[model samples]
Target: MSGIEDLLREDLRGKTPYGAPQLDVPVQLNTNENAFAIPEDVAAVVAEFVGRELRGLNRYPDRDAVALREDLAAYLGHGLTADHVWAANGSNEILQQLLQAFGGPGRTVLGFMPSYSMHPLLARGTATAFVDAGREDDYTLGPDFVRAAITEHDPDLVFLVSPNNPTGTALDREVVEAAYGAARGLVVIDEAYAEFARDPGSTALGLLEGRRRLVVTRTLSKAFAFAGARVGYLAADPELVEKLLLVRLPYHLSSITQAAARGALACAARLQSEVDELKHQRDRIVKNMRAKGLPVADSDANFVLVGGLRDAAAVWRAILDEGVLIRDVGLPGRLRITAGSEEETAALLDAFDTVLERRPALFDLQEQAK
Candidate 1:
């Protein structure tokens, strides 16, 4: 008999699952998670909200997640109502549902490379062909560049990640409009890190007025310190939201999750109070790294991407040896680091200092070239 490996789909025969290293270290600057913990006041409210649902354990959750969707809509505040919003266990699920509804065998989904990484993986999971159009060498997307790529691929779905992961590059509004104008398919703007953006008003949410094909995905995980809760949502046209219901599992979101998310939404202000600080640290990282002769990407997210390493893997290992964990996003000479609390940030910088003192050749491109 053939083994399970032999029975696996040919496309998935050599693929790796999407994940970052989950290791115990003195400081973790990987994965781009909010470093701050949820405040006690917010936790108490979430606990009370979740407690109320314990008595209804036997009953399935609200299959529609109507109230949760309402709360998410209110939080988003783009003149969107519950009809225009949808919730899921996480943004990853939301993306998957979209792929299921709009992308499948023979359909294509196009995305810029070095993005959230999961965009293509989710496409593959749904049997959708993924196309990488790639970005400029500096990792910025222009309106013309976006339109050209969308026109060339003519994908069924287009993913544009603002304050994009692993690079922290935010998409300009014109670029989003350009992609939407050129594509005949659904346009997805993954704004998972929008709360950390330098200009809060630059959100594509404002452009949702007449565009039915546009979707903006958001998550409370980063700003609200709710990564563990796994709450994510999206804002789109009501018709599109309805289509997701067909592909979503019944009672997909648990009552506890809905209640907790609602409670958190109620306390959005308090929960997101640390966002400014995180942005401060993000800028600090870019400034500090650039000063050290490293090329750091300008970030509007809670993380910074540093390039110019002679050996990124070796630098990663050296930093890990100092008990600091950052991400080596498979870029040849680059690494991504999350903005942590002041103390954690200091630890990360110190770890880098120590590593550079001992292994300058690994981190200093000039030295390596010499």
Candidate 2:
């Protein structure tokens, strides 16, 4: 081993960095990024605000990002205010900060498997113990199962990703509450895809009022077409938000970033229209995949998870050879497909049909409803 490797922290020595291939392909549907680009009017607003913030670059940006937090509070609209919100570069940083404050050596962070893969990485980065639990065979997590895991693991931090990544299934509100009641420490609900859920009320934000230990994180990356802006925030009791301040680095949110997020919030109407269209595409993908007898998960996010393949990697390569890129998330016999533009979706379906025609044995014809 290299001398530098020997000098590295023990917990980090053998760990590889998180990555998703960013290949240049004709129809890219691997990452769950918003299909639409920022509208011209919204782009103008972001440019204007950023231009104004450039003059004050000499001074330090707002250490607390108060103005941006206020705009985010208004955007969330669940009786939230600046004091109840905290902003960061992205949800990853926010999660890391939470671990810094609530998790450390000897403390445990627990999450169900097949959720956001980053949960364990964030825990390990903070020198925290990570516990992997299981979901139902169908990938739906029930309250009883969650409560049992919490009771057994007794983790210092519990992560629940609604509209979970890779699987794209959302948690019921009752399940969230049960987890909160069972957990002795902090509970964070990663709702990064909440904006695209089938029902507007399918959120843990409403459950935040009386629950101080509960946290709900939201991002502008998906539905808002602001992934490039890297804005993610959390809503919780002001007391919990205060604890994060102790661990967050000073001036974490750059002046340009703050202004850009606020500008995106100002153009919420246009952004919602884009989100609606993406939802349409998501539903269309789900419908078409099911008709072909694939077992597709019912999704509230901008993606669908399909199973019953004989070899997922082989299918993934076939799709790539057809100039379409989708994600093979290492789930046995399954692949995740991001909802793209109408033209892109059509291209992907055509690619799937053509490939399946050649290798009809690749997938099972019996459809499993989820």
Candidate 3:
């Protein structure tokens, strides 16, 4: 008899699930989660909201999630309304939904490589062809390059991640405009880290006026310290928002989740207060790492990507040995670290120092001869 694995989808049979190491370490700067705890007042409010739904657990939540979407729109404030927004479990699901609606079988979605790694995985799960258009050596997306790539691929969907993951490079408005103009299909901008961006006014939300094909996804995980709550949403043309309903499951957002998210949105200001501090720590990491002669990428996200490692894997292991955990994102000679609270940042810096003290040559760009 054949093994059960033989019955699995051929494409997913040997693929690895998307995840990072979740070791229980003294310091975890790997996942780019906001390190601060929710404020007591905010926590109390969220608890109250969630508690209110206990009596109504027997009834299904509003299939449309109207009130939560309204709260999200108010928080985003780009003249958006509930009709233009949709919520889901997380931004990953939001991306998956987009692929399900617009990208399945035979359709192609083009994304610049070294972006959110999940973009391609989501495409694969939806049975869509994923095309990687390489970015510049520095990982920056130029308008000319974007336009040319879209023209060549003629993809059905294009994913542009602003303040992109792993590298923390933010896309210029010209780049987004070029992509929108050159692509014949939908354009999805994953802005999960937009709250951590240096220029608050530079969001693609400003570009949504007449572009029905554009979608901007946001998450409360990074800036709002609500990672555990798993609330993510997207803003797009009302028509596009309606189309997602066709693919979305019934009562997708539970009453508890909806209430908790609404409660969090009520305290959006308080939760976002930690954003400035996180940005400060991110810049500090860039400045400090560069001062130590490592090539650190300029970051508009909560994490910084550091290069010039002689052996990224070895260095990662050494750091973890010191009770700190950062991410080795499969980039040769490069590693990524999240900006945590002050104490966690100190611990991370100290761990790096301890690792480097014993192996001063770790910063050497060239690999050792075999």
Candidate 4:
């Protein structure tokens, strides 16, 4: 019934892809997006920036993304200049670039399990082996585990996310430092959620002080509220930056994208207030959820992960019917709900309460287990 193109990859054939809801739903807590809208004033600036570049649309964008990179370096560096800064459509692309450059053809890409999911996906799509040495049930990464993996897997590239996705746990500096100790391969720290990390200064980007082989990837999508802008940057040593550039698509970042990204970067202070507001709300929801005996993960990112439910699908289905769309991690009862605005957060809580109540069998088991 199916054509040959459908079975082309052979390995990828019959694979069920992961996806979020496409149906129109209110209070979308599904995607880990900043629920707060970009402030009108900032939006105005971005609009102006785009307007300025309107005529240039006929021509190609800056292939090197020099202006945007300069702005990102300035914002992230707090004035220090680092030529290692690079950009792409989204930090996701930046990640793919790293994978393409370091991992391919008889090499392996290694990452801890239950991460952003793209690590292994990228490896698979590019004809590489994916090795997951992720944390077990408790969800903590031990330096010993990482060290053992390096010795065993000898991966060409290792991918890690701090404030790791789905589960918000962050690998502390010590663990990361240990990874950097090895001189063999590149370690990419996907800091896409770094905007909401516990302490901003403690970011891997700043930690790079002068280290080589540690590439820290960041995005404007989260804290900057620029998800539609598709802007993300990587901070690394100049040499590694050069290697990544070799494989980057020409004129990869559009001029409009560059202008908007640069404009947003210039307003970090303004964005921090929004981040603070979201964190406050997240803490409140988390505390209340845990107080009610729900097992929530220690998330270092913008969302909260509520695990240990009896049936994740039941909870997800119930909540969607209630007009709120929270993301299901497909891990059976693990939901990654974004920290929405105050009203949205309240609606989410109400939805959860309703869902848990309706799924009595599930919650009953939860209580009995507790």
Q: What stretches of model 2 exceed 4 Å from their correct place?
A: none
lDDT against the true structure, per candidate, is 0.90, 0.92, 0.91, 0.81
| CA RMSD of each candidate after superposition | 2.1, 1.1, 2.6, 2.3
Colliding pairs, model 1 = none
User: For each candidate, how many residue pairs have backbone atoms clashing (under 3 Å)?
Assistant: 0, 0, 0, 3
| Candidate 4 clash pair list | 113-134, 168-299, 168-300
Candidate 3 lDDT over residue span 1-370, tens digit each: 8887898889889888988899999999999999888989999999999999999999999999999999999999989999999999999889999999999999999999888999989999999999999888777889999999999999999999999998997888988899999999999999999999999876899999899999999998888888988889999999999999999999888999899999988998887778889999898888878767788878889999998898899999999999999999988889999999889888988888888799877777342211
Candidate 1 residue lDDT tens string, 173-218: 8999999999999999999999999899878999998999999999
Candidate 4 regions exceeding 4 Å error are 16-18, 78-82, 364-370
Find the 10 residues in a row with the least total lDDT in model 1.
361-370
lDDT (Cα, tens digit) per residue for candidate 4, span 248-277: 988888888899887787678888999998
Model 1: residue 212 alpha-carbon error in angstroms: 0.4
Which is the better candidate, 1 or 2, if ranked by TM-score?
A: 2
**Model 3 misplaced stretches (Cα beyond 4 Å):** 365-370
Looking at model 4, report the run of 10 residues with the lowest lDDT sum.
361-370
Q: Give per-model TM-scores.
A: 0.97, 0.98, 0.97, 0.93
Q: What TM-score, to 2 decimals, does candidate 1 have? A: 0.97
